[model samples]
Target: MIESSHTSPSAGWAARRLAELHLAAVFLTRLPLPHLRPPLPALSAALWAFPLVGAGIGLAGGAVLMLASAVGLPGPLAAGLALLATVLLTGALHEDGLADIADGFGGGATRARKLEILRDSRVGSYGVVALLLVVGLRWQALASLAANPLSAALVLTAAHALARASVPWAMVLGRPARSDGLGAAAGEASLVIALITLAVGMVVAVGLVPALALPMAGLMLTITAGIGWVATRQIGGYTGDVLGAIVLLSETAALMAATR
Candidate 1:
């Protein structure tokens, strides 16, 4: 009963649209649609899927850690595997963002200067420190929660989904710092998708940690808004790096909250 864009309602248009959307989601996330070629519209959908992608990555990481534990892997080794899985799954995209943001915010004397710093590929002292702290915090949090594999998995899934959701909100609430690049592509629908993802993430979190989900969601939202404001003020908008930093920080915050 669906129609194609080129045809009437009987042409399977809705099905095709859904297919395009799925392609976009796979491209943006880790859904493993290996056969489809990446197209612009699909890429657009993928952008919305970024948070879901993170959630998938988190789920995989947790599952790996759980499996290792079941098979009697050492606790440290299992935790390390989970961490490594996350890194590999995301290709450390957000980690790089966090570092860039740190360098830009720490080393620049003015807002314009900060934005310039973020564009630079060279890492700085602030970047190094920030990366170290983030990695350390994540490791500690995961290790502490290792005893409860299911809880850890839930935390990872929730964190990733929440982190990605921040990107759309940032795109909606803030301006794009540059005329071109990834940030500019984020539009109103993307922001809506991000909000919906956030709501779903919160629901999942509540199921895992009933006493803490509400407060955690509030904290995540507050931090996301603060970061967006800072980025907007500094660069007149956001860039891919800013979005990445938001994801990293939000995820870390969620992890910490769940542990508490």
Candidate 2:
């Protein structure tokens, strides 16, 4: 006694999956989503697309660099501008997370105190130092890589994607640090999703930059595990801000592998 539309089950599933992708894109980027009104379930399901969003952002940043170079800008200048574009696109989401994690871990004496520090809106000394190191090192690395636009684009694309994949990777390995907040709200991700995320990231990264694949993957995985360990020890679990720190540090490690 049910009225059915023309949509098949497989087609409906595909449509829902595509909606999750759109949700991920909207959440991760500054881009507008006029038609899509994804629910909280969609958001939770979209974690796998986090790296895909990074790929889009990285490619856009790389394109900006290419355009700048074509216009006669110096490699350093173009690199800085590309970094600026990425910051703008993501609204410095990960950057802010990095700052908070630094302030929390560096300044807090106890776990509760650390969590309290992280929730503050204002940046602290630890946060400032962390931001400077991350931004400065990223700028320098991008500048050096910018000498070869093709290589720069490939590595940036791969690094961003792989770095983002580390978030769910951490979530899979650690529990939420708090009872409530963004980290908890993300819910629990499964190991299968984590593995798929890592696999996709690995394939894309190695496919693009075959020469530095082994070293880059080795460094990225080591750094990712190291950050996860530090977060687990310091806070007893992972937080949203910790996930952000993981992305920035993981990307930096990968980019460093490509540096000459």
Candidate 3:
């Protein structure tokens, strides 16, 4: 009998990709999966799976929205619950980053000072205001879409996937601002990985909201590029906080575009 071992390489590749995706999910969300070694290289290497993980988060949140709405809850309340679901799903990981970036960039006078503020555990007035405004915008957008729960779910799912894709594009935007930490450890994704991330995100987003894809694309590109530019100018390069802010900002913008 022939060993028929020709399938080994492709099988192995699939296994590795699955493991990488699992790793990406663990890093991006508070999902309960078996523990695996989180080597920094592996985290950055798994950037290609960012959209997949994000889609899962969005789906979970959207399901909550649909369920709440189906139960006869008010649109505002259902939308609020949906937003809460995603926030708790990701353990507020990106929200913390957004706050930190806001506090750091708005409060610090020098580059070193800005970096110091970013590392602080305490939130400032700037952080508070940033969170309120951004999260409020998200709530309002979700409420508007809640009129049609199915449509809201689709838009939310796409927004999550597309926003995450922005993170990888940023990897190639500028060098890391610090010598250590998640940002530097993440480093820059290779062009292939970055492009694949973008492609997957676009495919998921467009497939979900075909008619709104054009507007989502334009808005996402503008916000992502604008955030990347601001991050580079303010701190010399991307940090974890900056990337987190980008995801939230881009996601909100996409949702708004879909609602519009």
Candidate 4:
């Protein structure tokens, strides 16, 4: 779920879109786009650009992997560098979300307690274990793809793009868990925005690696659907942490699928 958005019709179409992309870049990354003057697009309106953000992230990480490999780094080390680049770029936004969700869901005994735990900034044993498992899985999968630069780039790019497309869908999975959190703050995104985002992700991912189109799409959809379903069952709806978990898990699965 996109956490913040603001838009005004006063801005021209091109400028509005640029601003929207800028907004997405800022929220989803550590990019230095700063404040959009005025006449900014709403947070929900900028949701469609989430895939672009993912593509950029994937490309950035893939580039580092390729470059590091070119400089004689081992595939495993190159993959680690690539993952580090992404973590630095995004400030581990999704990873942090994943950890929070794991800790909250695994430790909390009740819905209210779960929400409270999600809000806590501290990491628990559950969060640490979950992060270790998912991050380890991602690192190993990426290392496997590092044998070919082209394949590495395509898979990484597709994985990130398709993974982020799940955001809007995750947002729409159900009502917000908290009236004051990400779910409620993101508001109700239109079906159109969600479809456009999905379309962009499909085009980018399939275009990058046409051979794995079905697998990529299938794993992404499956992981996201499963995560969203679990979120709904656990807390009646999706939370910010739940959405983050969706992004990381989906991305991890996509990267794994790419290995095929």
Candidate 5:
């Protein structure tokens, strides 16, 4: 068999891309991978693989759901356990972001106040309420979908992948809120990376559930964009907390749309 002109180079690129994916997975989730201790620049470059990391998280959640269900748990309980698995997997990273952003936006009267609120370690009333609402909605939506393990797993996978895919777009559309933080440190992902994430998300959505694909995509995009807009207007730009909030909210929106 004759090798194509592009074959060797493409193969090499794929191999390197796998490293980026591992970095992204490590950064985004608590899952153990061989530690490479790549520099910040390499981690920033790995942003392209964030969605794939999300997909892995979703699969882990689904596996939890399946195990719970097989052990005689009800859908609601299984769904809750599955959601819990994801929370643990990601160290509730985005959940914490959602709470901080909520508290900051709700309590702050000025941009400075908002940023300060975001920095505080304590959770306020706004943060508590936001977590309740988000977590409750997710549990309910997952329960509704979890009646069939296969369907629920597929939806979870698609929801997670698509939700993360929105982050690069959000990053590209909004500037960092400050001189330092994960948001600024991430720099600006290229349009190519953004589009690739979007494309991968679309494929996951359509492949998982053709009927809900358009609606899920629309919901995810709208929610993510709205988040970006709100973050920019409130804080002058995005921060690490803002990006985390975007991912969690987008995932919830996608799951709700998929279930409906």
Candidate 6:
């Protein structure tokens, strides 16, 4: 019986919301689902449900790492397993985005060319470097926080929520690079969804550390705005890869900031 202003109540809100959640899963991960044409509606809803998706990822990662530790896995090994679990769960979708973006920006001479480069499947040197740095940073961060798994889990939760929240703001402020693409679908993401995402992010932050919630919120806002600015200037708009890059960068930045 839950109703969201953005979607119809009479259209079986529960079913629609569940569908949206499922769509979010599909967008973020490699979860199997029936194919559908015109994935915009589902993708849009997925953007809104990003925080929940992140929570699920956090729970899965925490559980795996804890289980590994319980079985006498070393802290470093447990952390590695948890990281691998996250990559596998998400199907490395964001990682692919990050790599493509790196290749595009590094190789292209013009904006259009950059976009074209991003669409290419082949990875370049810049992409390889970017992947290494991102993965290495994340692994190191988790390892540093290994002594406190609860805090590590909270960090992951906050990072995922805040990272996804950046996409809506980017869409709102940036132009679409093309007449049609993932960015266009993302641009169609509603304000209600954005608000929902922000609310969820705040809730996760506050739940993690009551005293640090305000600071974390401020950090999240600042990082999101910064990334949005970069997306606008560099690409002259947003794209799926751009959104993915935002998620990866924002999450890394938030974790780094939180640690300090």
List, residue by residue over 29-54, the lDDT tens digit for candidate 3.
99788987544236778898999899
lDDT-wise, the better of 1 and 4 is 4
Enumerate residue pairs that collide in model 4: 5-42, 5-43, 6-40, 6-41, 6-42, 6-43, 7-40, 7-41, 7-42
Model 4 — which ten-residue stretch has the worst lDDT? Answer: 3-12
Q: What are the per-model numbers of colliding residue pairs?
A: 6, 0, 0, 9, 0, 0
What C-alpha lDDT do the candidate models reach, one value each?
A: 0.74, 0.84, 0.88, 0.87, 0.86, 0.74
Question: What's the TM-score of every candidate structure?
Answer: 0.83, 0.94, 0.95, 0.94, 0.92, 0.86
Give the C-alpha lDDT of model 6.
Answer: 0.74
- Compose the digit string of candidate 5's lDDT tens values, residues 1-260: 98666658878788778888877888889877788744434555776788788888998999999999899999999999999999999999999999999999999999999999999989999999999999999999999988898889888988888888878888888889999878888867888888888887787778877787777778777877898899989999899999899899989988888675
Per residue, candidate 2 scores C-alpha lDDT tens digits across 9-76 of 89988888788778778878788666685343445577888878888898889899888888989999
Best by TM-score: 3
Clashing pairs in 6: none
In model 6, where do residues sit more than 4 Å from their true spots? 1-11, 33-42
Candidates 3 and 4 compared by lDDT, better number: 3
Would you list the clashing residue pairs of candidate 1?
2-12, 3-12, 3-13, 4-13, 175-237, 177-238
> What is the alpha-carbon lDDT of model 1 when measured against the actual structure?
0.74
Which tens-of-lDDT digit does each residue in 1-260 have in candidate 4?
A: 88646655555577878988998898889877678878767778898899899999999999999999899999999999999999998999999999999988899999999989999999999999999999999999999988997689789988898888888887765678878987688778777888898898999987999888668878877887898888888888888788888889999998887776
- lDDT: worst 10-residue window of model 3: 35-44
Off by over 4 Å in 2: 1-6, 38-42
Model 5 — TM-score against the truth?
0.92
Worst 10 residues of 6 by lDDT: 35-44
Which wins on TM-score, candidate 5 or candidate 6? Answer: 5
Best model number under lDDT: 3
Off by over 4 Å in 5: 1-8, 37-41
